[model samples]
Target: MRPSIAIAGTSNSVMARCYAWVLSNSPDFDVVNHSRGASSSTVLPYALGKIDLSQTDFLVIDVLNNEENFVLLGQTTIEDVKNNLCSALDAAAEHGVVPIVLSFPRQNFLNRERVVHDAIKAYCRELGVVFVDMYEMVEDAVERAPVTVYKRSFFDGVAHIKRPISRLVGSRLADAIRRSFHSDRVATSDHALAFDRIEFCFPEPEAGLIERQNGFATEKIACLGVGESIGLMDSFDVVGIAFNSEMTDSVLSTDHEQVISLKGPDKAEGRELMTVILPTRFRSSRLTVTGEPGAKFEFVGYARHTDDRRARTRVARRSVLPVPEFDEQFKKDIALLAVT
Candidate 1:
């Protein structure tokens, strides 16, 4: 259950692809790659639910070039772009996704101040969505153009220039997404679930005794879960966990168990926890926390499998973890006791 992300923008949008590629490779993401061409408007289809809005935790909109062209060519005004952005933001909010607006990348020949990039940036500020400045990265690349021109030894041909510029833009966009996902704004909750430290370990030969050491080296694990009552589908964030295992030469491996410690809200005092266990063969696995009748509790399990033939042949039936079964009244009481 990796955090799902939705990317929206023009088909040729470099920033959109960069974010998509990064998220696709990210162990923490189950990415939904969405790109509409110039024929489509931004706010309409998104609001109509033609797109899977519920699956989107991160919404990235790159409207710089389109909006700028609209204003500069007299197709629209700054106010128009602002209005459209506002509508889009409202639509995203309605769908319960965190919207991120990306300022247009600076073009080599375009006058920066005259473009609608600033208007888009301002709109994002007004709407309270995350605003990322791609202009700075574009500006740096422009400044380095002279060296590039000299190295190429061809003044008339500008095709080679697109390569470096695209890389620079893509890299910056990826870096921004990486930083934003880990920011304090994301980790903190309205209630007070601030995680302190998280550690993951494999079950030792002795049941209930997790090895003090790390798990197998090759398996990469990332944890994603949600409280059963939380209606918001994309309500969780990926937390990095440290593990000490004997199977690997390295102390840490990307493929390992994901252990998360949940911090209670201001009024609550205890932590609710969950873990994602990555077996060697399954696509993913989930461990949920459940409370029992008195003070007892346990972890429940759900496993995922893809259609990979090799995995199916290698792995037998999935194992279910021991979990405490609670009756309706006890479950209700436990829910009432847990923090919002």
Candidate 2:
């Protein structure tokens, strides 16, 4: 079947419109055009279910700076655009769709072109989203023009560009869509793996907990088992179990008895002592440690399955040891690392 694609943006989002037009004309695509009235906010249409589609393979957003008076309003900040784009893309991802973000077209009146482009690039990087640099592509085309040619041939005014630009933009965008479709097909086909069961365990450190210190001794640690002894990198499906302090023992103490829903990895990062942060005000609970005899206390590693759809599981026990607290200072450290 032809891959299903959705185009969403403002009325003057020529990039989106052009993409729709190109996809409609392409033999390999089934296109859905969802572009609405030109505006800064796209969250409404997405949230209202107007753009929702089943089996949608790809989504394109091209409405960042397409309004009539956008440039005159004032300079737009990176945070403003990043938040809106993240919200829109997050909604699409909730339905298992991949999103493509289109950079704003290059306009001469905008003084902070590089800043805007860099911000968009950084946001995409942090979120692991795909990006298309329409501005750079168009700029290259303009620079190659004859010196005597009027800029009007390329752009109508400072902000809005002309139709010929659309054709050039459309052709390139169509090529990009085709390439993206091909890559997606390959990825979906190659990454399918079936699993019967998966488990994840984290070690919690309180008193009476077994503590292992790494070389630096900066952090006290515990070991959580990733069920089945499979290689850490092997991607598998899993079921997730949520546990509060009160219900800790019934879940983790048993072996694969009561599991919740199956879940795949939402996100994974470099290995560290994964600690579940409970509300500070909650009363402390107790847990039976696995290896350490006579150890029992509050604070447990949260248990979840690699596949969330298949089973429901919960923390069966809590461990006690001396662990570094993930307090406000730790959070600030993380924030600084993120900013740098």
Candidate 3:
């Protein structure tokens, strides 16, 4: 059987479908992508959770572009960047999967801030992680060329390089995977121990606690009515939720005194997955959904980290940017990516 490679990244990974296409064509490998667009390092743990690393050989990460964007918007900090990076690496280690972190080229407008990417590179060096400097590779390939070329050649005028450029990048990524085999496994001491306890919890749809509160289920999601409560049966520092797009503002309270107000997205945009931070960690707490009369909420899931800080950082969806038209040849592969 060929080795399997999984991708966890932002829009670049979703938009540049040809990269995974190129890798899948290689005789020596199989590829699966679990990338979501408009995401940052903040979503790595959630994305990585979807991958069964026991059957996967390598994980490729490309979130520096969005991470920097988050920093530029003041939604996160350098400290959070380090925590996010370490969370991805440490999670990969737990399953014995090798991780290859990629740094893609930033748009000309964002070229001024290199702090996030620099911190990532330094952290990788310190932990002996495999770091792929695709940013430098792309820059070196287009030496002495005008800057407008990136805008013209890229899909989003940023990191999402259009194919055959994406195909070329995929080929390079495959080469990097082969090269990683020669590297040593990460030593236990090399892990940034501070962010070592990253964990995700998904409540079962049929839990008795859910049924007792008049909670119902559609598909696999548990629906909680206003003033209803459900137990996750695990410790969590953050809760991920979504509500009916038409619902009015609502609030969620935990036994730990954590209360989060929920605002539904515009009816046109549909529902959105959001993260809510619990001010205090709870070992045996239950979350109760409360809102205005007739208001209801859907409890998606929760994430448990060393503290609430890691869960507080949010990366806003960037949908206003234009993306190039998809290539017909790669449409099948592109359709398979979780672009949202």
Please, what are the lDDT tens digits per residue for candidate 2 over residues 284-328? 122223423332222323222233331211111012111113334
Model 1, stretches more than 4 Å misplaced?
14-19, 39-48, 106-109, 112-115, 142-179, 182-340
Best candidate per lDDT, number?
Answer: 3
Candidates ranked by TM-score = 3, 2, 1
* Candidate 1 lDDT by residue in tens digits, 184-226: 4332112111111111132223224221211211222222223
lDDT tens per residue, model 3, 1-340:
5667888776666653467667766888877776655555655665666778777767778777766766776655666556656776665665666677777666653347588888888877766666666555444434433322333344445556555566655765676566554455433334323543445565574752232111111222456778887786555444233233233346778776767665532443333332221112344467787867876665545555555333221111111211123333233232222121
Candidate 3 regions with alpha-carbon error over 4 angstroms: 72-74, 105-109, 146-159, 179-193, 207-220, 232-236, 239-296, 306-340
Best by TM-score: 3
| Alpha-carbon RMSD, each predicted model | 24.8, 22.4, 9.6
Per-candidate clashes, comma-separated: 9, 33, 0
Tell me the deviation in Å of residue 281 in model 3.
11
Q: List residue ranges in candidate 2 displaced over 4 A.
A: 14-19, 43-48, 67-78, 106-117, 146-152, 184-340
Superposed by TM-score, candidate 1 places the C-alpha of residue 274 at a distance from the truth, in angstroms, of: 44
Comparison by TM-score, 2 against 3, better one: 3
